[model samples]
Target: MLPNRSLSRKLKIQSLCSNHKQQSSLCASFSASFSSSSRCRGYDDTIPNLKIGKHTRVIFQGFTGKQATANAKESLEWGTNIVGGVKPGATGEHLGLPVLPSVRSAMEQLKPDATGIYVAAHQATAAIEEAIEAEVPLIVAVAEHLPLHDMMRIHSILSTQSKSRLVGANAPGIISAIGKCRIGFQPLPTFSPGHIGIVAKSGTLSYETVGSLTRAGLGQSLCIGMGGDVIAGTNFVDALKVFETDEDTEAIIIVGELGGTAEEEAAEWITEYKRRTKNPKPIAAVIGGFQAAPGRVMGHAGAWTGLGEGTSESKYRALENAGVTMVDHPAKFGSVMKDILAKSGSNFKKMEQSLAQQRRSFHSSSSPLRPQASRSTPLNTRQQRSLHLSVEQNATILKNYNINTSPEPDQLPKSTHFVGITVARSARSPCIIAAPTANPHQLPHRVRRYPFDYRSGPSQSAIKSALQHLQLDSAPVSSKAAIVKLINSLWTMYKEKEAITATVSLALSSENDDLIIYDSDLLFDDAAFKSCKRQQDIHSLRNLTLLAPTDLEAEAAGIMYIPLETPASLKKDGKEPRNLIGTLVNGAGLAMNTNDVLTLRLLKNPQSAYPPTTSANFLDTGGKATASTISTSFKLLLSDPRVSVVFVNIFGGLTLCDMIAEGIILAFKEVGVDKPVVVRLRGTNEEAGRRVLEQAKLPIRAFDEFEEAVREVGRLASGVEAKTGVTEEGDLDEVLV
Candidate 1:
């Protein structure tokens, strides 16, 4: 084992020698013997390992490009085996090397094992596909700004191919200090031969790591950038596997950033590797973006974090919890790795020897790229028959496997289903209008109603007895008090011969027969009414004074179900409310937020001449609302004489924007909306959904930002011009703020 104090001194000496004029000759000598001896002898057919070395021939796609020319020249200067290049056309020779027209042509000439892509964003995907078709063992993709869907396709193509391994779309690529090979743009002098293997997401971070390691006298055996894209060709786990088998890689240092689960996943593999090998090589990690603001894109495409997503703090905790040495600073990575190497050096060397010995006799004629067969071969008939006999002889087998071959079927729990109640508005003002849901899976019978009438002044004993009979005896004390209070209040009103249109949302708990009161109103509060409109628990208990109760009407609108024929009697106000602004949203929070915005806009711009009652938004279609349901909601809003304009504000999460867009289109077709509708759609599939609305040729104006949508709606309703229209995407800070 190396001593920590002495190692730092040795590192200083080596650093001096590496910078000397004769360092190139010294590096060449190390390279000649390093690549062969360091080539992993512990190759397992089961493990996906791409052992790259100095001898590996490399080809360049888009060799004619300026970026490619510069990088390729640097690679050649660093002793990289650059065989040929592919430029499609106008490429005879470049930099004393033959430049071919295609990957296939270049492959025939050079038989390249690896390729680097440095093409324009438009042609990057095609270049990668060409390299894959030619079956280049390793591909280091350095092209940036490739479309997200195109990158997904590239990953798919690589996944299907067994023999190939991909590095990056926006990566620095891989380097072997000992092998004297540089595939990507890594500062060669910063690297020194030692024992650390680095697998990182960011190219700049990897460079910083190499510098740190070199300074610490713990130079890398292999350094691979797994790309900064969300979906890279290769991941941290793949690179770790290669390092795990390499004899030269005594320890590993993973450089990760925020905004991906790659670091967390690597921690899981590190834990598993420790358990399987019993003596794993030490691993240290540095997770970048610790101080980065959430949802702010930090240089790379995949470096932005969201709520409960790949944050640096979360990733650090994950690795630390898995026993990995988590380095907070880039400069500390080398020192941390040096400390680990000092204590674990001898054990790592022994593990290397053991791994090599273990794989010496593991041979199969099948291709290494193909999955290895299971160790257990097919069982004989006798063995199978013995197992069948055991199953017949014992019930333990079924219990052990939780296999229910003949177990009793699970019984659905008993539930109370309240039947529809009749309310007399003349003397008996309010009553519950709920009937048992006639669902097939529901209990057979409905809950029987109480016979004690409040109008007749039933005895206290009868009232208490009725409560017991209805199973309200086991209800919560507060609920019982509420019921008693409601009954007394109703009895007082019944005596006075006064009527009120009471709206109450009912939720029944079958376990205790307790009714959960969500919301109640003597007079309708439009904001509260809209908020509870789509709640599954809400049952509008209206007084059915002069008509027979119906099941379909009761189920469709709950207690608030206004019949088409009973419009005159059901109208609470003698005249319709003027200049009503209706809102359509997918969630209660969004509904509330949009309502708040409208209220503020009206209060702030009193002179803009908005109606006093226009503050209350009339509609909220909760998260579960489908296109058909949303259409129905819009129709009802437009049907109202009070409503002049509708503002549809949807911040979609679980619900998609496309689905909402389709609903808006359906509503326009069904209701023929003539009113000015200001629509704002954000979140999942926003662009596609916006296109759906735009193509429909509807008069609805769509805004990308919430403030703009609200401002436009307010301006239209108040008969004024909208201020400024900003379509910039809202960030996490806005949501939080």
Candidate 2:
């Protein structure tokens, strides 16, 4: 049995008994105050059944756009109650639905309960503002690549008196299978009506997990894709509160990944909820990016893991400590849930048996699962070419920002002890970390970390308190003063430069107890570089040679690309390197899951003729991509001499498959492909895209089934028949049983 199963029930009974004793002694005035103050109407309000249902009225902000029109048609066909849409400066009907000029107009005429914004990234802020201005209950912004500052401003607005609940700036949206309501672009065939509730940071991972649940006969009640950005409007705790009150939702699944403390926060909430309830719902989580390297940003803007508790291991431990079942892999989520349910007692066992029967009956039919896809003056030029600054360069830059820096090497006194200090942005706030070491590469376990308010900055008193806590109070007064001044300077630099992290090495001199800066490393926010002129001036110091050529090319081509393995890492002393399968995916989650499934298949068959297989790179063309962008992505992949095959997996929502197909054809004509190319297209405009690919007569193998496409890609990469056979019905009886 799971750890929290009966324990939760017992605790709930005790809580009830305790509450009964207190109820008689409660005063009438206290009860009235609690009732009125507890339920304020806001984003975090605990409104029961807040999940979109069959009767929830929805509207679109970009009603007249190609993406919006196509999505609206699908929603209407799927039985979503889309009353109308808002298209500024446009009128009349689109897809047989009334189109107004603005969100306010639609609110007046249609009284929509929710609004899905399908505009471009640059226009998303205005769209969200309009929806909030109209007080739309639920607002879903499906645009990706939104500026970080823009999201910051939007978050500020949301923190005010607004009544709207914003979903995604780059989210896949929400879907309620039981109600037949779809607010965003979720693969319809993979979903079924059942009791499980899912909240995920990645849309593609949510789709993959949902497919597994449905295959196990545990269909979803509601699936929410909390957008993957640095600052999201709705977070894990917000969704968990909603799920706790949803009567249809009996169990919960959280799909988290590397970067951010959302999972840890969720764990904290679950622990509190267990203490308060008798029979709290069981939760199971599958966190991605176990293989992710530290300090590497994997696809999502918010998925980068620096030092501290943002790693996947930390997240797993936190959730496990909270008594939540931690799944090892995304594919294993369903089976783990089944095991939990079976151990939940007779009632849950019966429900599990009923779901198993449903799975058998459903697989017996022919329905197919859908596929899911600053610089100073002269230094300005030098800064543009360098990724990080040298100690001298950093000192110079800091001084220009009104920050203090240690004197030059020749001016420093004889050193006796070395220490390290780092100031970086953490999940909730900016934190300062200090250690008594000179080795910059090694982070000691016994370091002191202090978190302070970003707005107020770190004060001298706070620095002294940290030093005292670390037992460094006996250090020379001059040395302590120097450390304080340096840290204050670093905090100022961190804020003004819009840096992700700023680190420095300090040497404490024996003479007069002085401190000198030995080395420094600074990592600025890339978003700030693009959005702020000041940051751009600082970016001029970037060294082009420091970054991967393919990354630079991808940036120029307007696509997101992250190299999984370098050619040098793949080579042995005297053996041919492993074949690299380059993936072209549209969503960050899908790209990651594709890599996971492919790696699993390769590992399952290790003795293949084509050597071990692995994804060479993770590429996302984004939701609002064009044919030219797709062509550019293919060209970039082909440019890599190590790539043996290219896998194009797309689940068209805002991105139409026809455009993707057209891009492949364009790449064939322009760059000339020599490697094996495998393509899988699903979602909006899939049929048209497939037709275009077939008509092009290019040397591309296209498949309607995701698993088949994956298998073919594996076979092409490994010169042998791919193993781990999965049926079109997703028959995982072996694993599930």
Candidate 3:
């Protein structure tokens, strides 16, 4: 059920009015007008056909493999128009489909419109190149651990060609629910054919949102999982462009998370789009990681916010400034869209009834979401770690590259002014930010910035012009020369070292009028480690002490882990003790959502014994996790003394539930289960996974429902008995800003 209409109206009015503070009265008038008449026309007949449809012929690379065969079977069952498949060094048939020797051979014989690459990470580049050379229109790469250098090379190759549009190197691929076409491993039951279009960076989060929408009588027309890797083949803007002209898509939902400037770029495009289009579709966005700590990498490799522009707050403000409705959480997507449609006077009852019936029928079917073994093994974890250089190391590298560096901290004189130099991941070149402060961490209110080309370096005239505009009282000729040389040297070092981000803080000496580096931190590109010998040499200088012991263990075990509680948070000086629930989940997005939901629920129930509750750590046993990795993850979580209970949430796609269950059982036998375990398993091989756990009779409670599992975990953590009823659908209402 939807929230109260009055409350929804109040929230909508507040959001619309907040943006136009100067003209509140005018905004209110416009808001009233918008509610009554800004209805999105259901589907434009004139719009061209979508990129993927029912009649689109599809094929598979690595066709004879176990993963591809399983996925092909599911796609066929879901009514995907799969014509044939390609498997090098193999002939004949698999799954009643022809398996040719190569992509070109399949192209000549079958003329497939799309191809799904289920190949290993190391082989992904070659498979994609072959598909591109054959001019396949749509290519989906499902490998999660593709090396950064390989992706960079693929991007370069893609830029030179205009034929193929790659979906993901780490993506779940695309699914057209209305068309009954599935190219990737999306859970089929959660999707329904409707007028709403969905695009997101996280696959599991998309599934969760789609489930809510489906239950609320809303179905999606098209859904695209854009993958959460740092450098993806398709971005938010690319997906938005398709939705902009898509006739079947009446409304759009964007699920953006912290990381890159994709959300900012999408906001800029939407601003321009609204200016030109007469009737722009309403857009509601849910940006994840609102409570995420700074400098901490979330579940996704690309989810860390290193730059100010990549922060969740920054992305939200940008999207809101572009007039996009901001949803606080994914659970609210259905309600927000329903309200939007209601205001537009779109009839919701008939469509809702139809979708509800479709969902019921789909659920009643005997088809089970089963797990399939993947042909590819996990990639070496060493290549995934990014090398961070300390102050002394950064200074040495700068000097080695002929760049100027400040003297030691003890030898430096009193500072007059401070300047910050940084090259963000998305930045074209280095930027010099000037602020009036000694603290390097504080972001100044008003700072003058000089952005120059890294290739050309900083020019003397440009530096002088920028200095004259500085907010400081005076800029002497000597100070200007010192700043120029400093900027030039930093730019040279940044370019030569292949650094992803080079943050330098420098102080201007009052006596000598020279700029001396006070603190320096550098992070080099992971791709460079594999290709550049200099980077390999510099890799030896990495500060191993910076990483926690658990972090190093998780890396060795080939799983991602992050401790949620700091040492201070765990130290309950005089306050009520907090209980830590250790979590194990697959996929980066699901890991974040699990942590978020657990935190929110715990915060709401303050009367419980655990007044301040949190997770012990954030762990993601990658998409292709094996039973061994799962066992290792359990060992790591149990090793943390602060952890009170364990919660395992698995949404099987590439990672199978049966495999996860087997891993849990293995951990019980190998390490001895000491803590109470709560497991919520769903998707491929869910029934078998649950049966395995039940048969084992281990000290674990397995649940098929998400809310039930969460409730159980909370009950165990708080030492309180189980609750009877679940919260009403609309009761957990978050403010939609």
Candidate 4:
């Protein structure tokens, strides 16, 4: 019978790829070659029933652990061929199935088909490697809090191997209802063997969506939790590839969040899928946290510092532009996705599920904390009691968590595709709807504060108005410490809107020409302008002498953010790099000195948001700084008509002064590029690189004297020093601090 398992699997594979199949031509009959499998034909509106078969064998990577035990019991109850368990002390003992210490032993004995990983964050790598050694086709790792570097290493590992499939380091396992089975942590009762292929980044959000669909009489073809980490094993594109082949999956819904360029990448893939395939699955998606600001560290750690990829605004824009419909928040996932599916001409009926089904699916009477009865494994009476207690405890905890708890089926509104309950925000008007709510239950359909088409203000005029608002119209603002304080006060008192504000022409154009990006993520809005005036005294945390600041002058000029760290004077070396001249900075970006506070009180304050000459703005070059990047960045500031000079503060982490010197030499080669760049070089390779610059006759003051260098950048930027007529622009447009 066990050998028959392998034969059955082979036959099934042949049937799917056979020259003449009786049923739907998923890929075999309609395709010319096996190479055509990549085409993912017959993907629209078909939900393949998940086949639970004997050929499917799984290995639990984290056996004998509490969470692992729960999932293991569920897997066994679901009739999975769970042949081996990788438990520490329990190795060599039988836990119903053989408990092996390592994956090799299990593979030698049972030859499992897939792996369900439930390892600790730190142990994730070893567990995955063991699975690879065992030759498991698909590996789903459900370990959270793995470091970014480790995840990247894992990603590197997966990229090289062709047969090995990796799911996540911080994700729930994937469950294919219509095919073979593997689940990470989804509530099994909530899922039905249906037509939609669901892929999501969030575990809790995925659960909510699954429950909603099940209640709406719609089951899933498969539900995969793609992990909400910086780098997951599988991306949306990979999952979509699988759904494309499955005859059961008629539609594909992807759930993503702000942070990481993952969603944007997914958007490009979806667009290609549409253009290439005849009957592409209509994609519905939910983009989470559109209401939240970037750099705020909202949900997942990956969602926090997306390395400039996962901004909510950028992700939303990219997804929509690619023609993949998406929602604003995660809550309104079902409704928006249903709308998209309906539009795609899928005759999706909102058949209501029975109350008994809902109760069973939600495990309402069974108790969510309790694991279902398992015949494959045995448990002690105390362990059984602990499981029951843990269920109740967890249930109680989740109920109080302000989480979107499982709602009663009948109480759920008769909305399309089992959209989540629209909780009333306030007693006033109903919550406004976010446009483009199209992702499967993973995307939220909330009220968008600003309309996507809210291009009411003229783009150019807005820039001009913004410049004028900063008082950069005629002359640079004065550097009176008290007067600077007042302007800063005016900035602090203004109320700022909580939406993403746009920017201008030469605003970091080299990086992204599509939008002429702002210098950084921080940009104050009109509301911030209003709120600044109401404040009595703007707390002067630190005064910064910004050299050639084009972006910060208009954006931060007079507003405030909380937990604001004091700024430090950046010179050349040892200490962290702060603004020595016309550079922009965020709090965590720059290094600080113990004396930054003293300097903030002593410095001559500048009028606009730009810091005063006595204090330097702490704009760390955001890692390595080459000369062209500096020059381009400087020019970006210079184009703003507010910049008078540019100051370059580089600690030279991998970026040596010689390369910067070459970049400066390159800049000088180009006419009309004459910003005085004050060079601060520190660290290894500085001396040789400096000599190269001196030999090249690049007009750079390579300095070992850190403080002296700052003084120079400061003096020129202060506008009190003798004006160098080196600039061809007639008058100084920008000054780097």
Per-residue C-alpha lDDT of model 1 across residues 1-737, encoded as one tens digit per residue = 11132332343243233223222223333334222222222112212435667878888888878878987887788888898798786568888999998887887888998888877666777888777667666778876545444554454344323445677776768888777777776666566766778988765456556655655555678888787664576678778998898998888888787654567668777877988996798888766543232223434555544211334555667778778886543445655665677687454332222122111111111111111111111111011110111223223322232221222213322433222222211111123322233121122122222222222332344335334534556667876665555444433432232212222234345455455432222221121223223211121333233333432322243211121111122235775444557777654323433443354344333443443423333244543457876777676666556667788876554356899999999988887888899887755566789999999998988976454555566666655443342223332111111
TM-score, candidate 4, is 0.43
lDDT-sorted candidate list, best first: 3, 2, 1, 4
Reference-based lDDT, residue 105, model 4: 76
Question: Residues 1-737, candidate 3, lDDT per residue (tens digit)?
Answer: 11232432343343223222222223233334223123222111112223688888999998878988888998899899999898887889888889999888888899988899988766778899788667677888877656554564455444433456788767778999889888888888677888788888888778767876886678888888788876777777777888988887888899888776678778877988999998888898877665454465666756765433345656767788888887654555776888888876666764463664433111111111111111111111111245766667878887775656664466544443445454322322344555455442343332334444333445444355445544333656676666666666666666666555555556566666666665666666654554334457777777678888878888777788876544344457754344678899897887876766666556433443344566667788987799999999999899877777899998787677899999999999887879899998866677889999999988898876565577677777766554344235312112212
Say which prediction, candidate 3 or candidate 4, comes out ahead on TM-score. Answer: 3
List model 4 lDDT by residue over 182-282, tens digit each: 55765555566667778887664565456556554566777777776655666676677777887777777777765445676677667778889987887
Q: Which segments of candidate 4 are over 4 A away from where they belong?
A: 1-55, 88-95, 305-310, 329-356, 359-737
Error of 3 at 463 (Å): 9.9
Candidate 2: 10-residue stretch with minimal lDDT: 371-380
TM-score of 3: 0.74
CA lDDT for candidate 4: 0.44
- Cα lDDT computed for each candidate against the true fold: 0.53, 0.67, 0.67, 0.44
TM-score of each: 0.43, 0.73, 0.74, 0.43
List all candidate RMSDs to the true structure.
28.0, 9.2, 11.7, 30.1
275-360, model 2: which lDDT tens digit per residue? Answer: 99998989998776654433456678777644333356567777888999875444455667777877764155333424443242
Predicted structure 1, TM vs. truth: 0.43
